[model samples]
Target chain A: MAIHHLESVFFREKVAEALEDQTLRGALQNATGLFRQRRLAATASLSDWEKLRDQARAIKAETLTHLDHYLPEFVAKAESNGIKVHWARDHQEACQVISQLVSEKQARRIVKSKSMTTEEIGLNHVLETDGAEPIETDLGEWIIQLAGETPSHIIVPAIHKTKAQIADLFVDQLSIEPTQDAEELTKAARRILRHHFAQADMGISGVNFAIAETGSILILENEGNARMSTSLPKVHLAVMGLEKILPRLADLEVFLRLLPRSGTGQHLTSYQSILSGPKRNPDQEGPEELHLLILDNGRSAILAEEITRQSLACIRCGACLNACPVYQQIGGHAYGSVYPGPIGAIITPQLAGLSETKNLPYASSLCGACRDVCPVKIDIPEILLHLRAKSVEAHENGKEAKGFRMWAWINRSRFRFVWAHRLARLGGRIFMKNGQPPQWLQRRAPVLGAWAKHRQVPTLAKRSFREIWKKELSRKQP
Target chain B: MTRNEEAKEAILQRVGQALNGGGVRAPRKHPITDQHYAGRPQTDLDLVSSFQEKLESVGGKVIRAQNLEQAFNELWSICQERGIRNLACSDAPSFRDLTDQAPEGLEILDFPHEQAELLEAEAGLSEAQLGIAETGTLVLDGEQENHRLTSLVPPVHIAFLSSKNIVLHLGEALSRAQQARSFPRTLTFITGPSRTADIELTLVVGVHGPRELVVFLLP
Candidate 1:
């Protein structure tokens, strides 16, 4: 439960099942298409949408390149402002720290706002294991918690469920009279949640950004619940990814404009929380203690890589997922990782390594829809190719000694490579009939065949394009 | 140290300045200064309206006007129709103007205290600098009171913005934000109502923030 990788494995299998399920596919397509349209409309309103994307990309890239400098400053400033800070290497450690805080409070019940990091760490499950009940206060998260399902979309978590299904859940779980009406369902959730908020012992949330210049944890939301989550609860725990740090507080003005337009096509979310330590001095109804857990969870590895480090610039706005054509067909679950989109396909492998998430690289169409819509403007398709190459390299290293060992050994030598290329050319000549591709290439080759499984083999001309282009260029130069 | 500090130090333990001349000091690429942002994206205000038109094209309700007064009237009527009181507003001039115009019985609080006092209110109203149609987000800064808590504390939040402020995407806003002399302590770009599907993957609104957001755009 503490590991995103383990959940990823479960997710991959579940998504594969989801893909084959006709009903699920239909629902996913409908919802993703709707969100994509909304995002497109929202982005169109910005006169310089593309330029803005470029700027965001630049800021994140610049900040991350110098994160070592920024993070410490943020900590110093936030600490000076009176906030307690903690570090977690991974979800396991993150959960332990949160549980410790709750236990120290001796608080039996905890109220939670929506936080993806909590999901990343499986904090609720972890809380339960340690004998604390963590109630999800975010309406969508609350529903999923009650039904025991994973979020279907980053922005709209429970996008896959219907009203009737929710009514049944309420009827079964809360013993409420079942009604298929969405309004009635919402009221039921509200009535039950208000009571939990009034008496919650602790509150937990996720941070959208942590300003280094000033001690600030910025959160975006639509519900009033998070305010209550932190205010009503005696203790508040905020968990965030390390990359959520921005250089200064005013920098938020840009992101504030970007995130809402990209994620759910709203002008702004209903709520934005900027917490500056717990109730300073004498305050009426805020958390007595404030804790911020910043998690690395193998992010440094991605940062270390030159090609993949741009992945860190991601704000987790979920725009790429919504804009992605592939994602529209398959939905987030199909990506089979917490990331679940163009960003996930590129990032999961880097964090987990190509060895674990090998299939994620090939999940994209390379149509560049995700890159086109990214608010932070990550070069997602390029990263997808980069990760794909890494995955292929891992496979080609031929970890297992098998039939390909001899072929790889032969291929290692330059002389052999030349001869092999000529021989391959000759074989291509033999296989060609008119313009039709070779029948042997039709089925799929083996390790080489992986590409062929879902791709088309370019028809070999009498001469390779490289040779023709070289000859023409030579003539022109002379 | 706060949770942010201890954790940042631990992470810093792994990040050797090996990349930055082996120095712990961060690169000062640009100091915070106020100037007309050069790289900030500029689009004719008309394009922003097109963005609004597009959102409306896709089944979203949008209001366009010239200033906060018109935006407020539209917002007031919208909330008043719902019989809402106990509203929260960040201490911005636009939001204050709306509060002044609010009906007598409809209570309005100017954001929350550091202790989150105003969070008890039923509704929240705030001023947003711009609306990005791309993510359907409204971007704001915590420079003013209630700038952070006003939009978050109330269940139903109504945000006011001028039509000129509407942008196409988060990136556009960031570009403009870079031009600020000093960025606020925090920036929040909110897209939809606060939501989470943590339980049984059921979509719920207003979990950690406001559930309903109405943006009144004045030209």
Candidate 2:
């Protein structure tokens, strides 16, 4: 398997570039604000929102802990229901399985609904390379795919793009007349994609929740493309991460309530297709064959560490992305991974090794907003801190570790701490002017330069708190 | 072993090892008592009105009818209003009687339709097996009546729902399906017409699915 490294630029450089793009920043701000406000209203409509979160989290915890038991049970039940099941240990195997199925069916034209798992595995590229034309049917995904870019947000893939940008892309790619009206753009996409759906030989989708008890997979979507994709095609393939399993069909009560409200602030999406298998003997519609590919893809490794395992509880609702302050400013593309925001910061590093994605763990300000909005109640900040520690431990002798060690040594005793602070104050007085570190000082201390690049150099207070306490405050208090 | 089997064994082994590892702790049990899974608090409104309100909020329209004849009358007017010359419908026995009453000059293509004909249909009519009030969702069982395409492909989808089938929430509808003798091969819960806010967060209805979802509640 090949490691697909994120974009070449460092995380800070990406942040700088993102901040410079005023249009992208404005789009992200508007989108996140809307999603946040809607999610608040939707959650408030439910009196048992907190209890639902707890129930969802508890279900996820139980399911993940005993996933080894449930996976087989699900496979057994699904097979009994006449759905062929395939297991993939990694992205390479997952892609290979899909490619084989495509070739076996000789499926040339394929239509797909929005699936983050497929994006993570880079499935479209593989299919295209194999001489298959895979069309993304989701409106946002189609827009991004046409622009030759990746999704910027989980739920709303084109969140960072303005309507004008999409209009330009449509004019350039689809050769349609340019229009800024969202309805017109959507109508254009629907007109074009419906043709693909009519001719498509294969359909692919992602599983929202796979019930072990009933051997059914529920796919929730608002656009109804998922239904068309899975229903119209001769062969339907669903790819799911191992963690998508729930023990019983009843568990959907909690998740179905939480996911839509958290993602798009809807009571329910337009369509929830609960499919148990392919079309039955007497059925006149639906796919002739159904294939379910369960991909591990480093999730079991995440499950190894108890704290990190909580990251897998995510349902990919994108609620955390909406609530995250860092994500609001920098946006999803800045993370340079398929998954982004607070959940992405934790997940990307674990799935793709920490070394490749080391900077992602530090992306958050530890404000706990993501945890608060997480439908499954994943302790994302705690997992982020744990990943940061892992990153540091991996590079024990690196500059960051040495800097931390020096700072810790300086604060070992009262005398050393006070003396170090006074020395820093003296340096601050010389090197810092009007809260700006001089260029020479920045060049001389590369660490400080890197830190101050994105932030203002804090000025030491005119009088230290200790000095004020020792001089006048003590006597005044008495 | 073949590659597929090898991968499966490896994955199961890894999962087992991860679960047994010292770092992973046993999950705290949360038994689903009725207290934990109680239905949402009920308001004073009736289920049908609640369903109508919930559905209408999401861009779906609901009509109240005294009987199938009244529902068919409303459907004919809608078809006339939309200038629908051809309509596709499900083949459920109940719908067969409704299709027979199709106004002159209107082509009623029943289920088991050719893909091309279904694609060009101006409107479609189907039957909902259950109605969920909390979300204003209609449950369509594909096996019972071949409605997968009729309710989905057309720009206008009008579904007939018996008032007695309306439930308070999704859980009740799902539980009924679970308790059924044979679960539906495919059950679709539709809350509204297909919509998207993907382009700059602008709400666009009737994207890939029906643009107009009209449900007639038959008493």
Among the numbered candidates, top DockQ falls to 2
Q: Sort candidate 2 into its docking category.
A: medium
- Model 2 chain B, poorest ten-residue lDDT window? B30-39
| Candidate 2 deviant stretches above 4 angstroms | A1-5, A410-431, A458-478, B23-30, B35-39, B43-45, B97-100
Per-prediction DockQ scores? 0.20, 0.70
- Per residue, candidate 1 scores C-alpha lDDT tens digits across A1-478 of 1335344545456656776877666767767776678777877766777766766676677678878888878878777766788888777778778888878899878888878778877788888989988998777778788999777677677766766777888899999987876656777887788778766788888888888766778777666667677656768888888888888655676676688778877556655767767654442235677888878887765666556778888888888877777777677776666667788888777766666677787777799888777888788889888877766666765544455687798789978876766777787677745544455665555544544544665554556555777878667875
Candidate with top TM-score is 2
TM-score of every model? Answer: 0.72, 0.95
Query: Each predicted model: what fraction of the native A–B Cα contacts (within 8 Å) does it retain?
Result: 0.29, 0.77
Clash total of candidate 1:
93
Which sections of candidate 1 miss by over 4 Å?
A5-15, A396-478, B1-10, B17-27, B31-219
Against the true structure, candidate 2 has what lDDT? Answer: 0.89
Q: Give the per-residue lDDT digits (tens) of candidate 2, residues A66-181.
A: 88888888989999988989889888889999999999999999999999999988999999999999999999999888888888899999888888888988898889987889
